[model samples]
Target: MAKDGRGAPVGRRVMLGVLGLGVLGAATGSYVQNSYDNLLAQISSRDPTGVTGLLPGGGGFRFYSVSESIPHRSDQDYKLTVDGLVDRPGSYSLADLHAMPSTRLVRDVQCVTGWRVPHYAWTGVKLSDLLDKAGVQPGAKALRFTCFDGVYTESLTLDQARRPDMLAAYRMDDKPVTAAHGGPVRLYAAPMYFYKSAKWLSGITVTDHVEPGYWEHYGYDVDAWVGKSNGRDDDPTS
Candidate 1:
């Protein structure tokens, strides 16, 4: 009788031990499934169309498709020409540009596709200063910018072009830009996404009205504000 009673309690203990193991297995399975789902969600998520590609440092960088790539020329070969509508249509070499007063700014670089890198340091001449030197005409309501990438072009109103935030950048992060990064010269429009900052930039033609650029013609908003334009609901980096 004592042996029977002991067997009954042992049997109950074994059952409880098996039940605990089952519960633990179920919990572990649920945790693994949830973790897998979360990883899949992150992997499957797509960036918005026209968004800039990621850079090496875990920072977001944007690329503008230009018509043609202009090889980086030395100071002797580099010539920035101003033609279109100006009194003193002239050409400037790299040396001439370097001689001019320089301005340095630190601003967030926003991309239309939904990425923003803050505090990118840029050093260059002000667009307004250049326009002033070129002596833009009274009829000039817009400015068309051309790049070495023969396919890409951008246009901005005179008011927009003259904004303090607009820059004809020569350096990024305290160093000269490289060919892979639109070097020698590039437009830097801090208020807009990096695409608006045309790479391999060459020409600035002042005109009477706005002209849609490459991306603009393809349905991108002309005025690509950080959070307001491009059909994005993201917050502004600025």
Candidate 2:
């Protein structure tokens, strides 16, 4: 959810309706549901149409866009860059990222607003591998993530970024990430709130200190550990 610029539907009221609708749709006819979902998926850009988000959701993911009508990036045009406070800066195409060592994890995704998707399969390259290859320089304290969606941003301490669970994810449910899912690449912040896992991920920059993300500007916790911050007391996500 963009505190302002983020187009995602982070508002609790909107998300409540979204979650409610999907469950309601499940009781309807299968053919009717699938047809509606297919039509919406084809037309969706950053997310399936806002209306479709109310009809049926796949994999328990709640759907909403960062903003209005964000043009989806094609697989051939996607690139992810790693730079800032590093000895070696690099830009990687989707193919280049895919060629690197990959890791797969099945982790539950928890949204700060109170919804959870359990045992979701995510596959990607570890951010630690990229940090090591980039030769993190002395005094670097954190990593900031920027998204192609043009509004949402996220951050982690260097120590947090180096956690084995952090990833630059490219696949989900054993399928190549689709635009509706924030694809060809996105940040998979396994142990944090789902919002910390920025969608349409494009840049990773090492920095001297942690930078507040978009949502942070509007009072959401900067350190969004699931069930830990923001008045939520629940299970540890990891």
Off by over 4 Å in 1: 1-57, 62-70, 234-238
| Candidate 2, lDDT over the whole model | 0.85
Consecutive 10-residue window with the lowest summed lDDT within model 2: 50-59
Which portions of model 2 miss their true places by more than 4 Å? 1-59
Report the number of clashing residue pairs per model: 8, 6
Residue 32 C-alpha lDDT in model 2:
71
Residue 35 of model 1 has an lDDT of 63
TM-score of 1: 0.72
lDDT, candidate 2, 155-204, per-residue tens: 99999999999999999988998887888898999999888888899999
Per-candidate TM equals 0.72, 0.75
**Model 1 worst lDDT run, 10 consecutive residues:** 50-59
| Residue 32 lDDT in candidate 1 | 62
Residue-by-residue lDDT tens digits, candidate 1, 1-238: 3554444577788999999998987879656655654554344345454222332223446454454554565546666777788888888776777788898888877777544566779988888988999999888898898877567788888998888878888899899977667778888887886788887778888889899888899899888777788887555544
